[model samples]
Target: MADELDWQLCRSFLAVLDEGSLSGAARALGLTQPTIGRHIEALEQALATPLFVRSPQGLVPTEAALEIRPHAEAMRAAAASLRRAISGAEGGARGTVRLTASEVVGAEVLPPMLARLRERHPGISLELVLSNRTQDLLKRESDIAIRMIRPTQSALLSRKVGVTTLGLHAHRDYLARHGTPRSLDELDGHVLIGFDKESPSIQTLRAMGFQMGREAFALRTDSDLAQLALIRAGAGIGVCQVGVARREETLVHVLPEDFVYSLDLWVVMHENLQTSERMRLVYDHLATELKAYALTSRR
Candidate 1:
């Protein structure tokens, strides 16, 4: 056993974990099956542990492999960030900037703005990761993030775009059939779409007096995009961004005065990224575009 370990072996291990077979890992990494096998064996030997065990389903990671997976993932993220930083240094704004945002915003709000960025700055390459789970900025999991809440991490640069205003909304057809609720109490009689799993954001809504539970919703899903789609499809009334609802003529704002909610939106990046021209260009564009979008929600 040696004090130093090879990062390449960890990469191969991750590929095998992701792809589920040595041949698949090989194809993914553009190497032969034997090379992947060797890397896994070498890594196991270096650590004096069996990383994976043979199973009917192919290869299954052993406990040891599972234990080390997060560290390896962190290494991968750091390596990618470093590569992007180096690439951006050579050319002005012609390098990759990986950005992360919530599923709804990424799917509904960001596409047009990103298209504009691509058209204006063809040299800049972008990678967008859409997830409800927050990507860690300190670990460099993403170069930039569009966050609903203000970032609390120190050593980070952030610009508050504006508050994203959410209100109860339904398709005009749904409202025509079910009849619009005149007040919050009247909501009990209408079909409602909402979250299946309660989250912090949901808790915030609950705190604001919209007490919601799984039983309360006629349709339930954790995905924000799915809820929005359901609202658009005229399934039932659901909470939606006022700005997004304004885009669709069919969607009717349910209750603006009595049932309005908002979350602070911010563009966040590592403080170190301020030195990179590419990072700044993308960050500024996101801040400006998102600010305008949030403003519309206010109206």
Candidate 2:
């Protein structure tokens, strides 16, 4: 066993953990399956512990693997940040920048803005990770994160973009077919699209005086995009950001005064990236563009 841990080994280990199979990790890392297997073996030998065990489904991670995963992820993030920083110093904004955001924002909000960024800085390559769960900026999971809520990590440099204003909305056809619910109490009689499980958004809505549950929804899904799709298909009434809803003429506001869910949007990155021009450039660009987009939600 040695004190030094190889980064490549850690990468393979992480890939296997994420993909749940050597073949999947091999494809993800652009390496041969045997290469990935060797890396995992070397890593396990270095630590003198079995990281994973064979299972009927696939390679199931051992307790040791789960414990070491975060440390490996942190190292990966640091190495990526170092490469970006060095590239920024030697040249200009020419490197990969990984950005994470909620699914709806990633699908609906970021594409055009990222396109504009690519136009402005052709050397900058972008990687977007879309997930509703918060990505840990401190761990360097992403170079920058566009978050719906204010980030509380002390090591993160965050900027409040603006409020993403949400309101109850439905397709015109659905409203025409079912008629509009005149009040909150009347919602019981109407079809609704909402989360099938409790999430931060659902809890927030509950706190805001919406007394609906999973059973209340005619169609249920955790994905914001899926919910919006259902709304567009005239499936039922659901909540959507005004900024997003405005793009579809078919989506009409159901209760202008009744349901308003505003979440503070933020763009955050690790403080270590302060010196990286590419990171800074993307951060500023996101702040400016996202603020403008959020302002539209106010309308």
TM-score of each: 0.93, 0.90
Error of 1 at 50 (Å): 1.6
Model 2 per-residue lDDT at 33: 100
Off by over 4 Å in 2: none
Model 1 misplacement above 4 A:
1-3, 207-209
For candidate 1, write residues 83-202 as lDDT tens digits.
888777786878999999998889899999999999988989899999988899999999999988878888889999999999999999999998999998999999999999987778
Clashing pairs for model 2 are: none
Give the number of the best model, judged by TM-score: 1
Model 1 worst lDDT window (10 residues): 1-10
